[model samples]
Target: MSIAELQLPPSALHGKKRVLTSAFVGTTVEWYDFYLYGTAAALIFNTQFFPAGSDVAGTLGAFATFAVGFLARPAGGIIAGHLGDRIGRKSLLVVSLITMGAASTAIGLLPNYATIGVFAVIGLVLLRLLQGLACGAEWGGSALLSVEHAPSRLRGFFGSFTQVGSAAGMLLATGSFAVAQALTTDEQFQAFGWRLPFLASAVLVVVGIYIRLGVEDAPAFRKLKVENRIAKAPVWEVLRYHKRALLVTIGLRLAQPALFAILAIYLINYLAARRDDTTSGVTAVLIGSAVGLASGPLWGWASDKWGRRNIALVAIAGIGLFIWPFFWFLDNGPLALLPIAMLLGMNILHDAIYGPQAAWFAEQFPVHVRYTGVSLGCQIGTVLSGGLTPVIAASLLLAGNNTPWLICAYISGLAVLSFIAALAAKDPVGDRLRDSDAHDEFEVAP
Candidate 1:
C-alpha cells in the first residue's frame, strides 16, 4: 500500500495530540514502575532479598534477580502482543499498568532475606519477572496506540511520546529514590525508604489506568478488528513474515539497553566499588540520571524534523565518542564526575534516537500484527543487547579493567553497529497499514 492509499479517520476522536498524551502517560507510568525495580536492585535488593555473601557475590545475586525479569520479558511480550492484537490496545494497557504496580508493591512488602531465607530471594525474582513481563507488553501497545492515531508524516514525533514517558518514568523513579534517600538516614533507607517508592507506584498506576481508559483504541487496530483481520498467532506470523524487521529492531536496540544498564545500574556499582562513598554519591548520580530523561521527547521531536536515520546516527556517534571522556571525568572523583556522570547517565546523546525508536520499529509492521511484531522484536533485542550488558560490565570490572574509557568504548561499539543497521533500514513513515493478506504476500526485495 502507498502513502496516498493509507486510510485514516477524520473524526475528532482520532486527534493526534490526544493519542500522544495517552501513550505518553501510560508509558511513563509503566517505565516508572519498571525502573524503580532496577534502582532498588542496585541499592537495596542485595541486602534485603539476597543472602549475605561477599559484596561482589551479593551484588551478582542482586543482578541475577535483575536478569530474571528480563528473561520473562519475551513471554510477556508474546502474551501482551497477542492480547493487544486480539482484544484492544486500551484494555491491555490498563492491565499492564496494574500488573506492574501490583508486583512492585508486593516487592516492597516482601519479607527480607533474614526473615524468609531463600524464599525472599525467590519472591523477589518472581516479582521482578512480573515487572519485566508487564513492561514487555506495555510498550508496543502504547507506541502503536499513538502511532495509529497520527498522520503518517508525524508518526515519528507522535510515537515518540512513548519514549518521553520512558524518560519521565526513569527520571521520576530515580528522583523519588533520591528524595526518599535524602529524607531518611542510610539505615532507614535500606530498612524501608526504598519501599516507599515501590508503594507510591500504586498511585501512579491508578492515574495511568484512568488516563488510558479515557483514551480510545487506535483507528488502525479498530479497522482491523472490524474486518476480523487480527492474526490468530501473531507471534508465529511475525516471526515467519517480518523476520528482517525483527532482526533490525533487535540490532537497533543494541545501544539503548547497554548504555542505560551501564550508566544507571552498573555505574552505581562501579562507584560503590571505587570509594564506598556515602548514599549522597549514589543519589547524586541518580539525580544526574534523572536529568538525562529530558532528552527523550526532544530527541523524538528532532527525529520528526530530520530523518530518524540521521538523528540516530548522530546520537550513536556522539554517545560512543563522548562516553569514553565522560567515564574519564567520572573516574577523576565523584565531584569531578557528577556533572559528567549526569551528562552520560541521563543518556543525553542516546535519548535522541531512543526517543523516537519505538515508533520507528512499530511502523515497520502492519496493524493486524503490529503489537506482536513490535513487542517480540523489542524484547528479543533488549534481551540480547541489554539483559547481559550489566553482567558483562561487572565481569570486565572484576577482570582488573574497570576504566570508564574501556566500558564506554565497548558500549559505543554496539551503538555504532546499531546505527549502521539503522542506515540500512527502510523508513516506514509513509507506508500503508498492512491488511491481513499483506503478511502472506510479504517479500524481501533485494
Candidate 2:
C-alpha cells in the first residue's frame, strides 16, 4: 500500500472522457442552480420577494439575499472539503447536486412577498443558503475529479472542463431567462415567467446525479485509500501547515470572481436602468457566456503549453487595462457595444484566468489535503469578492449618480492584487503531483 507500489495503470486512467463529462455536466447543473438566483434577483426578486420600496432599495434587498448564499458557501466548503478529503469526492458531488436542485425547485414553488409577507423573504434567504452550500461543495470535488483522473501532462487542459461548465451554466441561466422574457410580456414575466428557470433545474439535476454516480472516484484518492495516507484532520492541517498555499489560492481567486460578479450580476441592473429594458443586458450576457464557454478550454490548453502563471498574469493584466474601456463601451457607446464589452471583459479577459484556475489551485496542495485547501481558499475568496461585488458596485453606482469610475477603480485594484499573487506562486507543472507526499511539510515551490 506504499505510494510507489500504487503506480496507476493505463486502464485506471482510461475513463478520463467519462470523468470529464461527469465533472462538466455536474458542475454545470450546480452553477446553473446557483446562478439562477442571481439572475432572478436582478430581474424579478427585487420586486417579487421584498416590500414595495425605491428601486435602489429593492435591488439592495434582493442582492442582499443573493449575498446570503455566498456567506453560507465557506461553511459548505469547509464541511464538504473535510469530508471529501476523508471519505470521497463522488458522494459529495451527488449530495451537493441534490441539495441545490431541491432548493432551486422550492424557490420556484414558494409564494411571493405580496402573498406571504416577510415569510416569503425568509424562505428565499433560507433556500439561497442551501444553494450556496451546494455550490460551495461542488467545485472542488468536480475539479479534482477531472484533474486527478487525467494524465498529469494534460491536467490543465482537462481541468478546464470544470471552468467551461461555469461558463455553460451562466449561458444556460441567461438563455433560459431570455427565452422566458421573449415568451412573456413584462407583466406576465413578473407574474410567473421567472419561475420556469428555477423549476427546470429539477430535470437537469437528475441528469447530473446519474452521470456523477456513474463516474468512479479520482485515481489520486483511490491511491490515497490504498496507501492509507488520508489526513485525519484535513481542515486543521490546511489551516496550520498550509497557510501560505491557502493564501495564494485565495489571492489568485479574488479578481476573477469579482470580475464575474460585475459582468454577470451587477451589469444586469446597471444596463436596465439606462435602457429601461432588462432583456438587452441579459442578451448581452448570454452572448458573452456563449463565447466564454468556448474560450475556457482554449485558455486552459494555452496554460498547458505556456505556464499557468504566465497565462494568468497576462489575463489579469488584461483585466486591469480593460476595466476603463469596458465601461466606456457600456456607457458612451451605441447599443451594440454592450455585447462587445461583455465579450472582451468576460470571455477574453476573465476566462483566461479562470481556465487554468482549477489545476493551478489543486496543484498548490498535496492530494491528502487538496480538497480542503482548494475548496476553503476558493470559497473564502469567492465570499469576499463575488458575494459583495454586486452590492458594492450597485451602491457605488447609486452614490456616484450612475457613474462607473469608482467601480472601475475597485476592479482594477483587485486585478493588481491578483497579478502580484500569481507572480509569487510557483508553477509546478513539470513536477510529479503524486510524489508530493502527505508526510512532507507543506512547502510552496520557490
Model 2 agreement with the true structure over 409-434: per-residue lDDT tens digits: 88889888899889877676523333
**TM-score of model 2 vs. true structure:** 0.93
Q: How far out, in Å, is residue 224 in model 2? A: 1.4
For candidate 2, what is the lDDT? 0.85
Candidate 1, residues 412-433, lDDT tens digits: the string is: 8887778877876656432233
Question: Cα deviation in Å at residue 163, candidate 1?
Answer: 0.5
CA lDDT of each prediction against the hidden true structure: 0.75, 0.85
- What's the TM-score of every candidate structure? 0.88, 0.93
Worst 10 residues of 1 by lDDT: 437-446
